[model samples]
Target: MSYRRLHYHLVWATYRRRPTITRDVERSIHRTLRNKARELKVFVYAIGNVEDHIHLAISILSTIAVAECIRHLKGASSYIVNREHAGIDFAWQTGYGAFTSGDRDKPMVVTYVRNQKRHHGAGTTLSDLERTPDDENEEREE
Candidate 1:
């Protein structure tokens, strides 16, 4: 048997960073994301969102690419949200940020995701959050 442990901190925003995910629809969106994750064989350890963006701590299967998983999750959730809530055209940003972590840091990542509301409430915006090495590299390249 093969052993694999892959954890990712996934971040994505709504189109134009609009605050489309309000309190009234947050639960439905989260539920849809969870359902989509299950279909993709991904394990969602934690998921939380503020107004315009969301954070997910997931353990993805070795067989699935991170981008592919995110595509499905975002696509399905947007479809459901738009369907249920009329007059609201929901869509995700073109790109996403993904950072990989190990078992040792899983607890910390989960806590971070779970406390998103408190963090944002305290004026700790998403951009103010810690940046991964990938983020730094992207910044330099840009």
Candidate 2:
């Protein structure tokens, strides 16, 4: 027998950072993520989103790589969302932010992921979590 716990805070955005995550599609999107996570034997602690991006706090089995989880989740969610909602051109941007969180810090990460909308609305978002690769490039170009 073996024991291991791996928690992660995952974040990603829509294709080209488009604001396509609307109220109506939010349900479908979350459902898709949950379903895919279950199929991958991953546990989703929390999920939150704004118009363009999403956050997921999850614990993945040692057997699965974080990138593989993201690839499947994003691909299935995109497929389901676009299939369910006709004319919605929803796609996830390539690349993601995967930050490891210790078991002791898992609760905080879950809370942060769960409150993404409020955090963004109240201007209390943690910059480190909100930033993406393109953001860095954009900053350098400034």
Candidate 3:
């Protein structure tokens, strides 16, 4: 039998980088992301978020496109958040970052995703994992 394994560390910000992901909605967003991933036959290893952005460690089947998987996760999570939480305008920013991780480094990536808040707080974040497309533009303009 043929074998395949793919994993990615995905990061994206909220629309305009607004702090829409509050404490009350954090759980809902994480749950929605995981549920949506499962529905798409993707495996979500870990998820973490702050007020403005999120990080996910996931494994996708060879048949699934990474962009499509991210689209579904973002769309479904925002939809559920808006529906469940009244008066919240939740939307993701235009672009995202997807970094591939080897099977051996999967555990480290998962740990990083799962401890996003702590990493951010302690200033221990890995820049590459934390970068979004917005950062790319800033770098070019610099």
Candidate 1 wrong stretches, greater than 4 Å: 125-142
Q: How far is 97's C-alpha from truth in model 3 (Å)?
A: 0.6
**Best candidate (score: lDDT):** 2
Clashing pairs for predicted structure model 2, backbone only: none
lDDT of each: 0.80, 0.86, 0.84
lDDT (Cα, tens digit) per residue for candidate 1, span 26-120: 88789999999998899999998888878999999988898888889988888888888888787877667898888998998888888888888
lDDT of 2: 0.86
When 1 and 2 are scored with lDDT, the better candidate is 2
Q: Give the alpha carbon lDDT tens digit for every residue of 67-128 in model 2.
A: 88898998888888889888987787888888988989988899999999999999999988
Model 3 misplaced regions, further than 4 Å:
135-142
Cα-based lDDT at residue 88, candidate 3: 79
RMSD for each of the candidates: 5.0, 4.1, 4.2
Q: Please give, for residues 1-142, the per-residue lDDT of candidate 3 as tens digits.
A: 6678888999998877778899888989988887888888899899998888899999998777988888788888888888999887677776689999898999999999999899988999899898887633432110
lDDT score for residue 139 of model 2: 17
Ranking under lDDT, best-scoring first? Answer: 2, 3, 1
Write down the TM-score for model 1.
0.86
Give the winner by TM-score: 2
lDDT of 3 at 87: 89
